[model samples]
Every structure is written in C-alpha cells, then in structure tokens.
Target: MARSEEQFKKIRDQRYEEISNAALKIFARKGFAGTKISDITSSINLSHGLLYHYFKSKEEIYVALITNVLELFSQAVEEAESNNGTPYGKLRWLTELTFKGDFDVALDRHMLLMEAMQADFLSQDTKEQIIDQYTTALKGIGRIIAEGQQTGLFRDGDEMELAAYYISLSQGITLWNAKGLYPIRVSADMVLDPLMKRG
Candidate 1:
C-alpha cells in the first residue's frame, strides 16, 4: 500500500519531464527571453516554487532541452556505428533512425535558433558544447560515407560534405514538407542514384 523508492523516483522524473515538455511549448510560442517562470508554471498549473524544485533556472531547462536532443543525436551515431553491416546499410539505418521521429511537428527550428541567437544568457561554453556534439555526429556519418566510397558504393566527393548534404536535405524536407514524404524511408537509391560511384 506504500510507494517504493523506485516508484517515487519514477514519479519525480515523470513530473520533471512534464514540466520540461510544457515549458518547451511555451518557450516555442514566446521566445526564451520573452518567456517567464510564471508562463511555464501557469501553463502547467504548477506553482513557481514547485517548478524550481526540479529545475534551478529557466536557463537550466533550456540547456536540458539542448542536451536532450544532443543525446539523441549521439545515440543515432552510436547505433549506426554499432551496426555490424555494410557502410551503405549503416547509412540507410541512420537515415531511417534519425528521421523516424515526429520532428516536423515537435518543434520549430526557426524559433529555437532565434531564441539561441537572442539569449545573451546562453553561455559561450554552452554554444561550444552544442557545436562540438554536432561535429561529432557529422563525423560519424562522414566516416560511413567514406567507407562506402572506399568500397566503390558511393560517389567520389568530400565525405564530410556529403554527410552534411544528406542531413541538410532531410532537414529541409522535414521542415518544409511537414506532412509530405519524410525520411524518404531513407532510401539508398535516392542517394546512390545521384551520388553513387561512377565508373
């Protein structure tokens, strides 16, 4: 009839996630600086004090959001590398895995970028952290592309540039064609047809 320590921890983590999710929506609607603790609190009908019990500051919450996404990105890289398959196969897997999420409807890139650009409170270190993680992710993808090239499966181009283009194309499609063809199922032919190895 009593909750165990594990149960209590689960409940606490759930509540923390609830606050973060709600705050993100509000932050999206009204830029970060324009958002207030009260906005997040009122949106979730939680007291200001209660929210602070989980997060020390709004900046912390924003950082958590960024860190959360970065973790997902890292996972994608790990999953691709860990796959005991061909380079092309791994790249395809990465494509499907990365774009499988509901990113189009989840958050707006413009809003988040604007907030980051305008937030003076965002520390330089935080910006660097983001950049570093992003570069790592890119390299993971680039390595696969390079492997594919070495095996004569992919075209002869800059590995990093090709990887970046793949990401850019997927992002562009997801951002603009929210309800349209997405993940393109990460079809290998779509990539191969254009950038495949040529004799």
Candidate 2:
C-alpha cells in the first residue's frame, strides 16, 4: 500500500521539526558560525547522512529555526488577541504572553538567529527573507498599536516607532539576560507599567 499525501506530509514535518529543535539547542549554545551539522546530528543521536535527508546544510537549518521562531511568536500574539480586552489590553496580553514558560529557550534561539543575520554564511536571499519576516512581525504589532490609538485605548504616538521601540526593548532584555549582566527578576507588569499609566 502507498502512503497518502497527508501522511507523507505529517512524517516530513515531524522529521523537520526534530531536526529544527536539535539545531535550535546547538545554535543557541554555539552560535550560527560555530555550530556544525555534526553537532545537530549528535544532539539528536542521528547520523549525519540521515540528518542531511531533511536539511542540506547548517544554513538551511538556521533558516528553518528562524522560520519556526517567527511562527511561534506570531501564534503567541494571535492567542493573546483572543483574550477579552481593548487594543492596549491586547498589546499588554501579547507582551506578557511572550515571557511565559519555555519562552527563554525560544528567545535564546532568536538571539542566535539574529547573530547569523550578520554572518557571510547566510546567503543574501536568506538574509532578505529573515529581514522580511521580522518586518512583517513588527508591522503586525504596529497595526495593533494603531488600532488601539484609533480607538482611544492607547495614547497617541507614532505607532511604527512605538512598535519598533518595543521590539528593541524585548530583544535587549533577551540579550541582557543571555549575557548574565541582568537577573531575570523583572516582570511583564514592570515593562507594561509605563504604557498602562499613559493609556
């Protein structure tokens, strides 16, 4: 009997996800330039040849990792949007949703992907794809902020600038914690305090 297309897709996705999860851990630990395909295969207890059946190279794995992170982040925002709230409330929900359990692991993977964006190992097309993904994510957040402003739920300001600032702030916190320069004692409430007070 032949496998159905849906079943094939399910198996393919499962294998890809396994490879990506292993790559995420290795990349987070050793960074993009330092990580090797062998490292990913070893982490998952798979032979290099079997790993290559799913991903051709480390660059492809890095791109897959970035794509996965963006999808997860987008899903987090979407889930937060479903909660009862005004636009500002939704934004707050989204911000807090990002820091929930296992988010630190995702954040670490995100930082390594960002570092890879600066490397020559990534092709120009891949770099552009990553940037486009980030820009789309930022614009999605900006749109929410704009909606809040229009509804008078959030204070008036340059929505794009505000969105960009928030993204930078989140990334800064991730980087700071990764460096061990700051303790992860801060709460989402502390980060949202200013926005809440202004609204």
Q: Give residue 2's error in model 1 in angstroms.
A: 3.7
* TM-score for each predicted model, relative to the true structure: 0.85, 0.80
Q: What TM-score, to 2 decimals, does candidate 2 have? A: 0.80
Per-candidate RMSD vs. true structure? 3.0, 3.3
Off by over 4 Å in 2: 1-15, 78-84, 179-182, 196-199
Residues 1-199 of candidate 1 have per-residue lDDT tens digits of: 9999999999999999899788777777777878899988988789988888999999898888767767777788878988999987897787776556666433454346446645678888888787788789889988988988999888889999998888777666566555565534445456445556778
In model 1, the runs with Cα more than 4 Å from the true position are 105-119, 179-194
lDDT of 1 at 122: 89
Predictions in order: lDDT:
0.76, 0.74
Model 1 TM-score (2 dp): 0.85
Residue 156 CA error for candidate 2 (Å)? 3.0
**Candidate 1 lowest-lDDT run of ten:** 105-114
Residue 49 Cα positional deviation in candidate 1, in Å, after optimal superposition:
1.0
